[model samples]
Target: MAAPAAAISAPGVLADLLPASTRARAVARDAVLVLGGAAAVGASAQVAITVPQISPVPFVLTTFTVLLLGAAYGPLRAGLTLALYLVAGMAGVPWFTEGASGFGFPSFGYIIGFLVAGVAVGWLAGRGGDRTVLKTAGLMVLGNVIMYAFGTPYLAYATGVGAAQAVEWGITPYLIGDAIKLVFAALLLPGAWWAVNKFRSQD
Candidate 1:
């Protein structure tokens, strides 16, 4: 029988950086990645700054982390990382924003969006979208759009507000922050690539 696939064989920037010579080594690397990546995302979710004006949707670093993870890990592992985070949070890990955890929370939609964004960003990164600043930023913008696609409608439904109100509360208020995040996330992948190349040259 053919060997089983590695946990993180899906192509992306980080996968290229961490290639393994053997299937066994690849599997080991993937194991560490699955667990460590999930934990890192969970921890990032905890860096929440509540905008009372944007209650139920605090300004957290989760989105930034999600985008970065996806660009680094590829779609499958990035999606799995977010899924594991959701499961742990739902199971009362208190890792969600402001130490909150549950399925019924209004902000839960964004968490779901994280999974979608992860896949989208990872796919784009795998396609070399992450190699350049502009392309990477564009991919991050797409990821952000995917996030709001889930988040906006859910915000409307959960709060019993109209679509306009949902946009007002959940979308508009965060546009600047999201843009800032996209720029940073966009820069990260290319920067990592530069760092990797630099380190390789030193060897």
Candidate 2:
């Protein structure tokens, strides 16, 4: 005899919220989570903060949203969420940062990176990486590095700039802001877990 549905392990915040008794409900719940997560990411991308004379890339809230999604959802759903965002944007939805779309744009590299980072960070979170402040922060930094890994090279290629200048323009200007975002995400994940635990205990 198999264990009851409630005995099954819930890997992340989202899994905890969904019913595991049937495959159909699980599929529907995952679909809803992925769609909702994609919308949230798109909404965050629109909240861009521009800083001219520094770099072409503007600081956006997408990073924070991505990290949160990864921590809340697990790797597969998080990746799907980001993939949906990319596909929707490519299909002419102005959900990319600064209300832009299409595949040819240089910043789209970062968007691609978002998918990769979401998967990586979500995997980490699935393993309890986001349960502690230090571990969560480290995972957030890993996500940022993954984002820049794809972003910086494509930035150089797209802008017709040399490698050095690409670092200056695409990577350097965003370091401080990324660090701040990293810290914020790090704190937020553990705090959310604490709140979730507290609520569960009360229940």
Candidate 3:
């Protein structure tokens, strides 16, 4: 017989609520999630707008997608998903922003930041950081900060600009968009958890 939901350890994320029936099935499910998550990020990357006068780094939807996936998938799956995205994109997959690939781009550091922020967000979500509006908001903010931390410096190095200039080009232009994304994520994650709980109660 399957273990009762209450008998299982606390779930790291919503995905963990659907426990696998067997060890092999669990592995298969995780593999699928990783691949699916990576594809989602890649697809979202295509939704980009570049203002050359403002920054070489195109504003993209991948940040919102990555953070949500991380909160939903938890640490291991999120990490693997982002790692796969990075490796595949570097190996000639035209999945990076605006169908670009093979690294060395001015925006490549933000891609790297996605991997790290995904893992960080997933780790926090595993500890119940995504279950409330305030906590989820903070988590999203931290994830954005992580992305900017890595991306700004690399933008500087890649374009031979000073730190202040990099911030002006790579980050300042996108602050409003980032804020909007963060607000949506803050609402969505906790709302999903509430839905999951309601479903489980009905079951």
Best by TM-score: 3
What would the TM-score be for candidate 2 when compared with the true structure?
0.89
Q: What is the full ranking by lDDT, best candidate first?
A: 3, 2, 1
TM-score of each: 0.87, 0.89, 0.95
Worst 10-residue lDDT window, candidate 1: 2-11
For all candidates in order, the CA lDDT equals: 0.82, 0.84, 0.92
Q: Could you give candidate 3's per-residue lDDT for residues 1-203 as a string of tens digits?
A: 66677874767797897669999999999999999999999999999999898789998999999999989999899999999999999999999999998888999999999999999999999999999999999999999999999999999999999988999998899899999999999999999999887776565
| lDDT value, candidate 2, whole model | 0.84
Colliding pairs, model 3? none
> What is the lDDT for 104 in model 1?
80
Q: Given candidate 1, what's the lDDT at residue 106? A: 77
lDDT of 3: 0.92
lDDT (Cα, 0-100) at 95 in candidate 2: 86
Least lDDT summed over 10 consecutive residues: which range in candidate 3? 1-10
What's the distance in Å from true for residue 43, model 1? 1.2
- In model 3, the Cα lDDT at residue 93 comes to 96
